[model samples]
Target: MAPTNNHRTRCGDTRFPRNVILLLVTIFVFLMAAISIAWLVMHPHDPGFAVTSLSVTNFSLSDSQVRGRYEVGLTITNPNKIITQVVLHRQGSLLLYDSELYSKAAVQTTVNLEKLTNKSVKVDFEVKDQHQKVVPPILGRDLNKGVVNFNVVLKVTVRFEAGIWPSKDELLDVTCKDLDLEFHPKTKGTGNLLGIGKNCSTKNAAGRT
Candidate 1:
């Protein structure tokens, strides 16, 4: 008699078990939910940045060059309960008549903020060794009007610390508009600027990193 052969076929061998598949799906849902909750809880309100004063020293324009020394005072207000670190770096410019008059020359000092605290910072800006090309337009203008209009643009990095997790830093675009100044012979072309009160706006909604 010839030997008999038996063959067995397996069904659905490559498919996952129903229980295992359910477990994986449940885990994915839970992870997504957690991330959503974290974001909602960590969302922060806009902080306050105001220019308290702007002082100028040795503001002069000659036939060859334009020179000026300036100091800008800013007050930072943190409204959140978490600690924050605000960094105003040197990456922007000062504009006069849409002209690039001065560049950011130094990094602003780092600020360590406590919860709901106010911090004051001063930025010193000076323009020297510049060409005379930007002077003719301003010199011919009436300085006796007692006001020169300027605009300042800056980029700041803000970091927040909450509980044990420090949120990723946020880059903010700060623009100070319509900084008007009057030159006085008392300071010999040096005086405090006007219209700098609460004239700054910060935009960070582009994206957070």
Candidate 2:
């Protein structure tokens, strides 16, 4: 009877630990499932960007340096159906020639976008002689041909607001590629962007599109 009692006690102790472990694992699984469901329900889509127009004035290339005044027009759209508003903050634009940054401008404005709505904004860059960047040989050659192809990149911090919830700030990169600026023959120093409704690609900081 004593041996049987001892054996029963050991069995009880082992069973207790196993039961506790099983309960913990079950709880963990349920918690993870709940978090996943919440994420799916609140997922927000990124906004879209399009280059509506680009204007260049006072353009000149001396030696290897380039100077110009640029105005970039953009159409920003919010495509999310559930998000109440999208706020874009601290925006900046970069002008690139063959992947090299030539000029940059700060957009000191906040953009508020409602759901399924679009807004138009313009970014201005004044590249004076003092702020001009030395152009690459390839860029100089393109300028001689009266048409120059450049890339416009927009960097912005974005936040999405739902009913009462606001998401964390996200950094986004918007790229408009192959923007051809054809210099006017008569004006000599002025040019306009060729192509209409050129769509820009947006990507997150993690390089996800």
Candidate 3:
């Protein structure tokens, strides 16, 4: 009779049913969490896009002897996800740091619409500085008191996929007065260059019609 009573008490334990239900619910929640985690790991976003890398480097000018082969280099990076149909087409104008010679080089940027994870690329630019025969009144005179700047200009066009990355026509204000008079001759070249004053120049528009 004592054993029988013990068995009945064990079977009637009210906490037993509650504990079993709680365990089942806990297991279901864990299973759901695991499945959700698996989905996130295996599936990518709709576009699967991310900015893995961003930088500007490898800028080189020609050997200074080549006539029109003024070579410039650039690089772009992408990592992880895939960027498809990538291309680069940069467009912009070069400017002088001063107001003397309108020496123009080329303002440019790199474009990559498609890239794979952890990838590096190089770009070669042929920065052309068109020489104008016309001479400026202050050809060699220091136009900016003691400030040095670029004396040339170049228009660049960088196109990637359906977007265009452009820069405000660079107002490259480079000072050259610190250089020795014998080495750095003070002479401004010819060209309609944009000056960096309170006003705006034609080269300041990132996207000009």
Candidate 4:
């Protein structure tokens, strides 16, 4: 027989320490979870939108169609501290109720919003003979009330900005349901916007029709 060795394995001692490996794996899992939670807590948020002003001109309604010119003023605010939001130039569609009206005729200037800042954006669109003949009877009632409420659907493409890395673009769809805007036929132009009602809400509509 060979001489007995003091600290040597017998022919088949290939097993590892199971307890140490288990501890290492548990630690790694907890570490990764903690990091994920932290990242979520620090994620940036969407910017803010508000209708600042509105002016309506050449307003008319007939048996054929409703023709009008509307000047809309908006304030885009970025409340984030480390992110930037870009509103693409003349890339949004505005709709009134169920009618697919107000097609964009020109290219609007791009707006670059810095962190913790606000920018004013204005858009003018015309309502021509393309409008639907069937008008909601309530339109006249609301107009007479000095408040013409319009449910506007706005869709725009935007991009997020961070440091160094290229940002991907996304679509933001805002549904201004029953946006109660003050209108005065007695006045020469569009009157003051009472305010976008509290019922208005926004949603991200990327990859949608």
Candidate 5:
């Protein structure tokens, strides 16, 4: 009887741990289901961005030094029906030439867009004097061809309000690629966007679009 009692006690101890682990796993699964349900009901969608225009003025590159003024037009749209409003905080824009970062600028103004509404904003970037960055010889060669391809990338913090619930800030990336600027034959310093409009791709910080 003593040996039997000891064996019974060890069996009880092992069962206790198993029971606890099962309870924990059940609770975890329940919480995950609840969160997933809530997320589906909310059905949040990311905003859309498009590059309406890109123009360059006073553009020059001499001795590897570059100076230019870029005016970028962006159209931002909120596509969420449940979300009442979306706010985009201050953001930074990067100008890239041949995948190399040519210049960077900050958008000081915060943008607000209502649901199913779109707004166009102009962002100006000036690279001159101390703000100018050195360019590679390849860039100069490309500029002489009367057309240059560039890319613009934007990093923005976005927040949306759905009814009374205000979401946490999320980092988003907007990439505009293959923007061709055609310079005037007489004035190489002035240029305009080649195509009608370029649509940019957006993704969240987690790499989800």
Candidate 6:
């Protein structure tokens, strides 16, 4: 049978029919999608993951004296990818409500916080407000029992070579930041021990009035 013009045109590699071209485009798109999926599945990141969460434990007054030492508990963990070596630096400065009392310190710690894991670390800070400084008479009592305001903040830097990189937040409102300072009598309300019973009046005294 003599070859039809349609067959000759097709065999000659002329412009493809619109429908045929559309079909080819669809197949190519599907193939590209498949390749992408395969690549993604095969090329998983070498470093497993980054930090899932970070937190500080608690800051409590270990002693009553403003010059007394204070300890802060903090934890930094890597919950995701594998990290080779993580070195964290934390610095804190505290301003006591009383100018006489204040503290400041800098600290650095290194850990091998593995991927998909958590590590517990403790940060200890001591505040000594008893530096040689004259106090104004109206400023109130000695540095020992005065009302003191204090805050400590911490910043963490993480380096991840094996897995994913992580970023940490600076702890605010916490004693670790060294931002804490005494709020002064105006804001501290009643005084510490001395002011406790000053307002107390016997029920009898109240009845007489």
lDDT of 1 by residue, 80-173 (tens): 8888889888766666666566556465768888888989998876777555564556643745556777677777888887775536578897
After TM-score superposition, what is the CA distance of residue 113 in candidate 2 from its true location, in Å?
Answer: 1.2
Tens digits of per-residue lDDT for model 5 on 1-209? 35798899999999999999999999999977876676578776777889899998998776646677888888888787644333343444445464344445645546777778888888777665444456667777878888888787776767766654435457788888889999987885998999888889988878898
Regions of model 6 farther than 4 Å from truth: 1-66, 84-86, 95-107, 128-150, 163-209
Stretches of candidate 1 off by over 4 Å are 1-36, 62-66, 128-140, 205-209
Give the clashing pairs for model 1.
Answer: none
Q: Write the per-residue lDDT of candidate 4 for residues 51-157, one digit (tens) a residue.
A: 76666677655554556776667677777765665553443444444545555535555678878998987777766657456766666666677776555555665
Q: What are the models' TM-scores? A: 0.72, 0.71, 0.24, 0.65, 0.70, 0.34
RMSD of 5: 5.9
Tens-place lDDT digits, model 2, residues 85-153 = 333443444455643444456445567887788899888876653544566777667776778887777
* Global Cα lDDT for candidate 5: 0.73
Model 1 residue 203 CA deviation in Å: 1.7
**Worst-scoring 10-residue span by lDDT in model 6:** 196-205
How many clashing pairs does model 3 include?
A: 34
User: Where does candidate 4 stray beyond 4 Å?
Assistant: 1-42, 88-100, 129-131, 195-200, 206-209
* lDDT at position 116, candidate 3: 45
Residue 199 of model 5, lDDT score: 88
- For residue 94, model 5's alpha carbon misses the true position, in angstroms, by 4.2
Model 6 per-residue lDDT tens digits across residues 41-70: 443222122222222212223234344444
Model 5: ten consecutive residues of lowest lDDT: 84-93
The true-versus-predicted C-alpha distance at residue 197 of model 1, in Å, is 2.5
**Better TM-score candidate (4, 6):** 4
Q: Measured by TM-score, how close is model 3 to the native structure?
A: 0.24
Choose 3 or 4, whichever is better by TM-score.
4
